[model samples]
Target: MNISYQLTQGQIGMLISMPHNGQLIPDDIASTMTEKAKLVPDTDWYMDKLYDFAQAMGIATIIPKYSRYVIDLNRDISGVNLYPGANSTELCPTTAFDLSPLYLDGKSPNEAEIQRRIKNYWQPYHQAIADTLADMRQQYERVVLLDAHSILSHVPRFFAGKLPDFNFGNADGQSCSQALIDKVSALDLSPYSSVVNGRFKGGYITRAYGQPEQGIHAIQLELSQYTYMDEPSDQYNQQKAEQVKVKLQQFVTCLADFANAKS
Candidate 1:
């Protein structure tokens, strides 16, 4: 119902998407949620802050204004599981990352409510992605989407042990080009761990939008929260963020160079 998101146009063919960066829950929606849900602890906290370099680098970006609790923008419109046979949340999630109930008894959104959210929240966000990518494809020989996110180092519901600092997912090489993958994998991410096509093999955004044949590449970077923030306090650590930003800058530069390369 409200302004769904913010869009920043860029001089280059790179678009950084932070679908889970938001933490705001409408007062009306907040009233129906449990105390833990109101906290919005599952958010991809401070993603915009961490990726501030994108602006100067002439990269475009789209940021959501509502929490994923309102509706997961990165998910499919049909509510299909992004990861089947695995414990996962819903498009209109009823539970948090810890598998705890988000809504109070009898407050969970039913089918009708879910439809409304899809129409209002989900549709608009995805439309922006589609339109922006389409425009990029028109102006450039290649365009790359960096779907950015951050999570706590450990979430038992999804994985057993601590997550790597940088988790790159390209839907098992179906999403982006092998060249871009090689570029990122070659980065010197010292003092941090990284994996490709591992636990996170890209989400809906990467899977749906990435079309290497069409010259539009998409990849997801699921960062470990401990790399840039104080997990216990949910606060930004400037020193820590600066260090991670260096690597992120390298990744972006590679993506930009890839996009600008002659086809």
Candidate 2:
């Protein structure tokens, strides 16, 4: 029944998530979407591939099977706004990142339908994350959850200027320990920049599950698509990926060491 995702568990105490990389949409839902929306242009395209090194490294990985247009698993399912002043998409976003409508006229889901989608699509994904973290905690003294995500370099709706190549979020340090942050921050992504606690300071998954005091450290990295892919066009280039994969491998190696580090 959990047909909406792919979960792979590695021997290590880390979990890599591609929550928004899904592209499938139910027939009924797809029929109601506009041509532009059908392309799912705003998705974290090729993120699962970008993070493929995690699988080889034996890190637990979880990815959704349905498009984020179905339910924003990164968002709070309770309907509370994650970014109040900023123009953000909802749990069931009806518009693209550019503010263009996704649904056909009057075909968007209503409140009752939104709740139904949450129960069917959203809750299961979250429960899987929670359960995985709990299970990992039982096996390792510490667990690191790396939430992987990406977007266009410049989405005028979310931020004013171009986004950094790496946007690491730890819920202002509440979702993780300073040690882990320091390790990742020291990465030298030359020609590519990074920021901690910037415009994107983690989302619901990081804020809700990260409990460093309890030995669970969570971090969310929102990468700029241009760093590893052809931006706006959304193409996946092998040469580009190969280059970025080197840096990513370094990043994941750091997380694995942090998780297995002795106290």
Q: On residues 1-263, what C-alpha lDDT tens digit does candidate 2 reach at each position?
A: 48888899899899988889999989888998999998999999998888877877889999999999988999997878877777888989999999999999999999998999998898889899999999999999999999999999999999988999889999999999999999899988776789999999999989998999999999999988888787779898788788877887888899999999877
lDDT per residue (tens digit) for residues 138-187 in model 1: 99999999999989998999998899999999999999999889989998
For candidate 1, the lDDT comes to 0.92
Q: Each model's TM-score, in the order given?
A: 0.98, 0.97
Off by over 4 Å in 2: none
Score candidate 2 by lDDT: 0.90
Clashes within 3 Å, all models in order: 0, 0
